[model samples]
Target: MPSQPPIPPLLSPYLSTAPSASLTLLTSTLGATSNWLILRFICAALKNTSSEDGSTKGDNEATTVVLVSWLRDATFWKDGGRKLGINFQKVHIIDALTTGLGIGASSLADVETEILKAITTAKPTTRVEGEERVLLVLDGLDFLLAATSCSTLETLDLVGELREHVYTTLLTSAADLPLTQSPTTPLEISHTALIMTMVHQARLVMSAKSLDTGVARDVSGVLRICKGAGAGDKAQEGEGELEEREFLYFVGADGGVRVFERGA
Candidate 1:
């Protein structure tokens, strides 16, 4: 019966280069929207790529499937905060687990099961000759320790290692292959369109200062990403060339900035 955290507002502007084709992300405050996006992408990619073609068009899927696991609680930190260098009461990880508020955060096993199920759904019949495309949409990854009140740094380390394994073994391996050139004969243009849309939604969530910033900027970003994989595309495609230019401004947490500004 943990209380829900306030859903942050959208701060980033929407990209609108491709109107007819765009990915807009809205959830009932449930974190599973990310899981759904990932699942859908995998399925679509499977359907799109010929089981006979040994190539994947998308990036690493495992890395995309991020999980925020909480291993400790506040009571453990009742003592003065000395281990983590932060106050536990200030940011309760359990609050992120309320089923309705967002995707129910769970343990490593739970996350693994969910991801495995998704992967199974898009299983490749011809392993050596088929490419399975998928993207994981994990948000708020930094909140993994939000609930742990005790010094469960060891547990945190374990989770981090687990994430790396999945990413390196499954996602990275997939990305290493040349799947983009493999023409998808069984999938629809709409399918690829949908996956691209999801990626755009993720970008918006990552870039926005808040959630309610209007889908305008987010939509614009989606279009721009779809039209061109990167943020730099000059075509006045989705919204306008100007909007596309603005989507490049990425503000990371303090002391951590992305290479956006020129010559940074």
Candidate 2:
């Protein structure tokens, strides 16, 4: 294993916050634009239930879809703080990377459950046909690598567990599309467009695409799924664009830690 180089201080705006009893949070400094775009999308998805007629209802029953961000990056928080907007009553930003990884085993499940509960509680009083999605945005997984002491294999196992749980849950409830799959494959398509649409509406916040080698596989799969779901066609017709990343960690084939970034 190799030591992690000091993360450039200039990049602090993008990384998660360091460990602390309390953080000096500056909401005004955060990047609110991305967060606002996401919020608006969620609102739009909920408001408009029809893809053909493009009809929508009022925002009277609209509830804030909980935004769960996992990152130790101050920039992510800052951006979120500034952009989360008035659509949400509360924003729970966990600043400590160490605490997030320490609780990593259960954190994914807990977050997923909380989002589902929030959505269920909202109950939009109409059949949510194409998609009814809850977006889970994760930033700064690089920090997760820094925080986790486990071997690379162990980390992969943990991540796999989280992925399985989420995919299974979404499939069972027919909620949301799994967008990371390749957009060209037919087998990957499902009735998850509303989920993908809502996620897009939420400004592309879910980090389901971790950059492990498996991440490539996942991305390929999601592309296939989304393409199969007609997302590719839709996107081409000026409907949307795909902005997903592959997951990566600081480990190798032999479970050794190393610092590397994509396109480097």
Candidate 3:
């Protein structure tokens, strides 16, 4: 396996914005290659915020991550846990693909219900003070959107609900209120509240797809920030126009995801 690439610094502007809700869509024709890469990225990111014991350190904050996958099995993630040094105990994985075996959800509705339950359970509440964060990862959204049992509208509605819930919960948190009511505060001035504000202003949509052109050694696809959010001030300089940014990436021998500009 190729060594995994370092987390793209470009993502820092987005991921560092805690207490903000953002949705990143990973798509590819490479049979879950992009999904796996993204999963690894998230695990790596979360691991940075934790201690050697897997407990969150500093910031008095906790991140609850729930992954809903209609593909792969526990074994797949188990491998990731070992390689990434991630404590799976802190991550909730829901297998939604198995059927007739009494192991997974039976239908689309069942899947939705399970996801909702997971999100609700993982989200931080008033009982847990301090900065609470939730990261919900939905793998195989294309499958759900294409399933005959679930209408497109229904799928979209579910995503909308999830986004709204995440946004509301994070924004209403005591630590985040100043970002909304006191925009001039140090935190607000420093754009500490930028991510939350972005989440409130628009939904983020990202897509990953295979590119026929070679981007780098062993690299096969490009990821694009298609809609919903922008590159912050840089994007705003376009006179209210948001320009889409694209990146070419590949999974290295170490199972790490490496990303770079399309032509770089």
Top candidate when judged by TM-score against the true structure:
3
Candidate 1: deviation at residue 88, Å?
38
- Provide the clashing-pair count of each candidate structure: 42, 39, 7
Taken over the whole model, the C-alpha lDDT of each candidate is: 0.27, 0.30, 0.51
The CA lDDT at 246 in model 3 is: 78
Model 3, CA-based lDDT? 0.51
Best by lDDT: 3
TM-score of each: 0.27, 0.32, 0.64
Writing each residue's lDDT as its tens digit, candidate 2 over 110-218 gives 5445545544554333365523333223333323333443333443343334333221111111122232234333222321232343233221132212222443421
Q: Candidate 1: where is the Cα deviation over 4 Å?
A: 1-106, 124-130, 149-206, 210-245, 248-264
Misplaced by over 4 Å in model 3 are 1-6, 44-61, 99-105, 124-130, 167-202, 214-217, 229-244, 262-264
Ranking of models by lDDT: 3, 2, 1
Tally clashes: model 3: 7
Candidate 2: list runs displaced more than 4 Å.
1-57, 60-64, 72-86, 89-131, 150-264
lDDT of 1 by residue, 9-114 (tens): 1111221111221222322122111222222222232222332232334323222222222222323322212221222222222222433122244464454455
The better-scoring model by TM-score among 1 and 3 is 3
- The 10 consecutive residues of candidate 3 with the worst lDDT sum are 167-176
